[model samples]
Target: MSKLLEVKDLAIYFDTYQAEVQAVRGVSFELDEKETLAIVGESGSGKSVTAQSLMRLTPMPPGKFAGGSILFNGEDLTKKSESQMESIRGKDISMIFQDPMTSLNPTMTIGKQIAEGLIKHQNMSKKEAHNRGVELLKLVGIPNPEKRINQYPHEYSGGMRQRAMIAIALACNPKVLIADEPTTALDVTIQAQILDLMRDLQQKTGTAIILITHDLGVVANAASRVAVMYGGKIVETGNVDEIFYNPKHPYTWGLLSSMPKINNGEEELQAIPGSPPDLADPPKGCPFVARCPYAMKLCENHMPEYTNLSDTQKTACWLLDERAPEVEPPESAIVGGAKVHG
Candidate 1:
């Protein structure tokens, strides 16, 4: 797989009256063409911030791009002016948010909403844009695209609105799609439908995808690879199978154990013991050490560098360091963890 998108040393910070919050630390990763990369982390772990940073859409005064480069299709988006980014957005990269209502204009007809992108980015004529919007709606599996396009967002159900959003995103056949918790509020059936649509469209368009969510089950079914983020950094990363079955990072282990199981005899789902570290004044050592079950003295005193398990699998944990004493990850994480490591 060749690299299609490379994010090098990306940092995003927010300024406030109290202090500055570094939402995205020096994070780096590469995504390949037609590949699905899932970024999993807790709610405030910089997952959404990183996704938003890709389009240079974050508010400047409140949210600033402190440093680094986002290389998309051999060009650095970070260096591009807003106008340049405007040309790139919707054509080169498009994003879908968690709430369709907020992203979609309530006042505009769905047809016009989808058509706007077609005309702006694809340079289709008014008549041509209208025709293409109908086609896109049909492609995303919405029923009666011709008539439905005339309706407002409120007229459509949650699932239908999400489908409409997907139709709008596919308007220009972008090279990359960033879906930030796209299935958050939808039901199981709707979530499955959306995931299927994304996968099917990805096959047809050959677009790379970045799926941001905390659901490990979603990653198992959809993503080709997974990057486990914590405290504004990637704690573990590997192919889908490797990350799931052979996870080495303690943070990944906690995540796996915390997932709700079916037909299990447990009284209640087990939760991770501690809260996430403070990003404002983050710990000097491993950010997860305060919460890690297997933490050691070295873990508290120093941070770990990225340890290479294979060409495709790497993690930032002292457990994988050659100098540290070897220890096996919990058996519970083995199913998913070993899939990556083995």
Candidate 2:
């Protein structure tokens, strides 16, 4: 349960002809050994960008690290040179990108793609790497590993291709594995299988994981802790139970209310109103103030400080202030048909 990775006040910006877009603003979180931390948010909330920054995958010139430090294994990754990062990228921390179809090289054999890291980092011979590739394929539940290894990515099914990506990311037995939307675009059955596989792999390998996704179901199924991101910032974070059952932030309430409930017959999903803020000209006050139902005048001009609710749960909202009016969460925000009192 030792701390393996810590991102402190991390900020990432993208330059454009018009303005500098703050893709991530003072975002922070930590990962423990052999744990799964889910970063859940809608698209463009900076979940992927934050995950990419861990490996220095965000392209420079267009993307730049504006501030903060990424501490992994007691070293600062933001300060590492590209050459230095190269040594740590696949071997120490690895990533399973969103799309296996596009991430995997079309021309290379599946075995060779898996072997590339083994050959580069482990210094294994081509023959040895190929054997390990087969083992990895088999480990990920791909049938006929011996034959599948020699086939191209186009030859495999979508789920199999995703499994291959996981195999590649896990090949080096990395300390931290960042799976950015690993189950994206897959059917429910396949998504379940992938989630099970990831959990099994984490237990077997003792590798910490950072799962980035917009699906609350996926977060509930896989993660122990959750960080709810919105408008390029983490508005609330806590253990899974606290986030799902006792969420404090209005943004978190909106997310929960939107989740489909099987028992709530004929009930419509409560979608959060308004579009997310534009990062290029983000609100000077609370990023969510425009959409929050209980927004005060103070929320329009100043960001609220985070209020610690428990040892593990914290949220940023004017509603949590001692002087602010008390407001109950909308009935739709209830997790299991049980009301959550503020």
TM-score of each: 0.95, 0.97
User: Model 2: residues >4 Å from true position, as ranges?
Assistant: 337-342
Error of 1 at 332 (Å): 3.2
Off-target runs (Cα >4 Å) in candidate 1 are 336-342
| Candidate lDDT values, in order | 0.86, 0.93
Model 1, span 111-181: residue lDDT tens: 99888888898789989998898898899998898899899999999988888988887789888999999
Global local distance difference test of model 1: 0.86
lDDT of 2 by residue, 177-260 (tens): 999999987888999999999999998999999999999989988999999999999999999989988899999999999999
Model 2's TM-score against the true structure: 0.97
Candidate 2 clashing pairs, residues 3+ apart or interchain:
none
Poorest 10 consecutive residues by lDDT, candidate 2: 333-342
